[model samples]
Target: MIRDIDVVVIGGGQAGLAAGYHLRRRGLDFVVLDAQASPGGAWQQAWDSLNLFSPAAYSSLPGRVMPGQPGETYPDARHVVDYLTDYEQRYDLPVVRPVRVEAVHPDGDRLRVGTDTGIWRARAVISATGTWWRPFLPAVPGRTAFGGAQLHTVGYRRPADLAGQKVVVVGGGNSGAQIAADLVHATDLTWVTQRPTRFLADSVDGRALFDHATARRRALDEGSADTGGVASLGDIVVVPPVREARDAGLLKAQPMFRRLTATGVEWADGTRAEADTIIWCTGFRPALSHLAPLGLRGPRGHIPTAGTQALEEPRLHLLGYGDWTGPASATLIGVGRPARDAATAIVELLSLP
Candidate 1:
């Protein structure tokens, strides 16, 4: 049966849930389709020790707040998963699980969303598919010939996996720092970044970073003349564990290696270090392959969006990909405003008389 809907949100992550919240508030009929059998989006796949840089108060979606457990400052992956599950049940959002969306194509004035289960015709489509599924690995010379075990951040789960092994953690981002911090106690670890890593002050956390970003975004939006330095979310927040690791002389990161050797990595000065495992925390690209049939993606594999609405396809709205789609749209705290705007836009488009 070809089901019809006012809107079809192509994810059940934080962004999708927020969009569903606003859509429900607007009294619009919508369905959120999730690829995962369970909730929590990509958080379900994060490392066991992974915790949000932000406190629970700052890491929440729309409507309800993320309640922190007693004495727990930052919520971990499992906490987030439980919150997401509860959020869905609380709002009663129409989310179909384990339904993989294969493609979205134009069908007259509507979009035909082809899924593994069945086809759905929607007046508007909101693509909230986050970037976790697409892990990026840099192209280093001799990478293919390396005999050591190599894994991306997506494949990493715990430190015990590389216990007693000489491990190399690559990338300068928060994930790289945190993972290296966690693995340093479990293994002999080396950290590699393209440049020197910048660690934020111990007092500064994800909440503070979000505030700074929000202020910067507001200034830009309001056409203000502020040219002061604005801290980005990419700046490593010295979380308790990471700070402890640094205090213990374990958070050192070296410049990127020149190339990978058969046994390990080689530096520009011809220095070679033997390693048993390499963890690449290079990051991820947006999961937009399902929208390829629409031919909306540009050379950079991104859809040109005007405040979350696709410039190429008006009925298609993209959410939670990153700053291009919306300011801080990829984070839990950042996704709500954009999701609300997206839902409002979808409703306005569908309500056209």
Candidate 2:
């Protein structure tokens, strides 16, 4: 059976929910198709200890503020899950769950969204799948030959899982830092980075990064000199756990290894370290396989988009991927503006002719 709608939102994560709110407010006939079975999208998949860079109040959706936790300064993953579940019910957004969209292609003037269950023919398609599904592992020689267990950050649940084992944590992003801090006391930890990890000023957090992003966007709009946003600040934020770990000299990092050996990894100078496990925090690419039918993606995995709207296919808008999609569009708070703009654009597009 084919259901006709004004818009089809892919991925019911933070970005999709935000877009759904705006679309509902705009009176658009739309439905959100989520691959996941339940609410809280990627937050449910995050590490148990993971918390927002900012406080709950600053890390909220479009309509409701994420109420602060009873004793925690920054809410954990579970709190975020509860908040998203609540927000979905609060707004009464139309969401169809456990629906995995297979492909999206143009069907005459509209888009035909093919999924596991059925087809949704829509005037517009919003791809907000986000990056959680596509965890990236950097290309390295002998990676396949490594004897020890290797897992991405997605597979890591807790430090105790690797307690007393020689584990190497790789990548220089916030995930790398956090996971290393998590494993320091529990495991025999070795932190490796592509480069020396740079921590944002102790005071800087999501709020500060959002400010940079906003300022950078305004500069571009006004045709002024480019002001680098979050990218300019550096790699990781000094969250409480990270700060405490670093102050105790537990979060120190080493340069990345040249290649992986069967037993361990080797540096260019032939320094080798044996490891029982390697946890990669290398980051993720956009989850955009379903868009391959559109034949619009550039060399980079990202579809070239102008403020969430795909340049190649105007009817297709890509949200919550990263800064390329919109300034700070991937963050919980940052996604709201792009979501609103995407919803408004679709409404205008649908209303024409």
Candidate 3:
């Protein structure tokens, strides 16, 4: 059966939830389509030891704040999952789950969202599909021939899987560092990165970094120079666990390997290291495959957007894909504003005569 709505939100993660809040406020006839069987979105797939870099108070979606457990400074993945599930129920948002979106096509004056279960015809579409599904593995030589087990950060669950083996954790991002630290307890681990990983000061956390980014963005918008010495949020925050690992001398990182050998990896300096497994903490690309039918994606595989509205397809808006969609839209705290704006814009567009 074909369902008609004023707006269709694809992907019911933090971004989608934020959008849902605003859409509900406007009393729009919208529905959120989530591919996951349950709630929590990408948080369900994060590593077992993964924790938010910010405190619970600072990490939240629109309307409601995430409640943190007593004595817990940072919330873990499971906590986030539970919070998201609760948030969905609290708002009574119209969400249809486990229905994977197949494609989004322009249908004359409206957009047609094709899913595995049915079709949703809407005047506007919001693509909030974040980057968790599309794990990007760099094109390393001999990668296909590697004999050892190789897994991306998404596939990683626990450290016991690599117990008593030589493991190489690639990428200098927070995931790479955290995974390598966790694996050090159960395996001989090596950290590899394309460039040196910068660690934020111990006093700084995800909240501070987010605030700095917000300030910078505001400064840019106001046409003023930002004099703050703050760096990008991509820099690793010295979370307690990571700090402990570093203090224990288990956080040293090596330059990236030249290529993967059948048995292990080869360094650029003619050095070879044998490994039983390789854990790639390399980042992710946008999960925008369903939008392929639109033919609006640029060379970087992202649809150009002006504050959440798609440049080519104005009826479509994108959220939580990263800064390209909106400043800090990928973060829980940052997704709210853009989502609200997108909701308002959709309402205005649909009301046009």
Candidate 4:
């Protein structure tokens, strides 16, 4: 039998749980469907050394505050995983795991969420599946011909995995910088960036970044001047470990190489660097393959969204992908506002008082 729910949240991560929290408050019948066998979502997959840019308190969801880790300023990935596992239990959110959604299809007024287990017909579907599964690698020439070990952020676990080998780290985002820093002392490292790396001020953390995003969102909503938001501050935030690497002059990034060689990489100026491994800290694209049945994805592979809802399909809300859905919506702290907004909108749509 097809289970019927008022809403079906397509993930059980921070964004999905946040949505569940608000929906419960609104007295809605919903279930968060997760593909993973357990809780913590993508945090369960993060590298061991990864930590949030913000302190624990600043990185929180809707109802509860993430407890501060006494000795640590920024919590590591395992800490995050623990908090998430606890949060799931604390909220008592209805989350069904190991149910991989195969597709979302239109079934009259309700949407049919086809999964490996069975079908769930939901009035509104919130796609909160964050971008961990879909690691992106740029199409540099001869990349396929490279003879060394190559991996993306999703494939990375620990620096010791590549111990004693010459490693090249690609991408200049926080992941790139953080991973590079983690590997610096562990391996022979070459950091490459498409352009000059942009590092935020030493003091800029998650709290400050969220504040900037909120301000920018507010200004845009008011149709006011452009505030630039968090993007204006630069890309990489110098987390503690990253700061240590920078202070030691180990975080320097060379110009992006032109292409991969059989053994390593070649630069535009004819310089070549031989490396045994290339770790692409390149980010992720949204995991929206289940929604493809709806034919809602645009040319850019993103569903056209207006304030979190698919412009073409109002019954669908794409949450926590990025700023396109909501300002800083992909973040733990930034996701609350958009989650609340989506829930509030759903309440109004169902004619709830």
Q: How many steric overlaps does candidate 3 have?
A: 0
User: Which should have the higher TM-score, number 2 or number 3?
Assistant: 2
Candidate 4 residue lDDT tens string, 1-353: 68988999999988999999999999999999999999999999888899899988899998789998878989988888899999889989999998899999999988999999999999999999988879888899999999999999888899889999999999999999999999999999999998899999998998999889888988999999997878789999989999999999989999889999999999989999999999998889999999999999896689998899899988899999988899999999999999999999898877742
Off by over 4 Å in 1: 225-234
Q: Against the hidden reference, what TM-scores do the models get?
A: 0.97, 0.99, 0.97, 0.98
**Candidate 2 lDDT by residue in tens digits, 1-353:** 99998999999999999999999999989999999999989999998899889999899899899999999988899999999999999999888999999999889999999999999999999999999999999899999999999999999999878888999999889999999998899988889999888999999989989989988998998999887767779999988889999999988999999999998899999999999999999999999999999999897777888888999899999999988888899999999999999998898888788
lDDT of 1 by residue, 136-241 (tens): 8888998998998999999999988889999999998889998999998889899999988888878887677667767767887899965342343346888888
Candidate 3 residues lying further than 4 Å off, grouped into runs, are 225-234
Per-model clash counts, in order, read 0, 0, 0, 0
Poorly placed runs, candidate 2 (over 4 Å): none
lDDT (10s digit) by residue, model 3, range 172-253: 8888888888888899888999998898888888778767767777787798986452555346878888899999887999
Flag the better candidate by lDDT, 3 or 4: 4
Which structure among the candidates has the greatest TM-score?
2
Q: Can you give the lDDT of residue 240 in candidate 3?
A: 82
Residue 89 in candidate 4, Cα distance off native in Å: 0.8
In model 3, the Cα lDDT at residue 69 comes to: 59
Which residue pairs clash in candidate 4? none
Model 1 clashing-pair count = 0
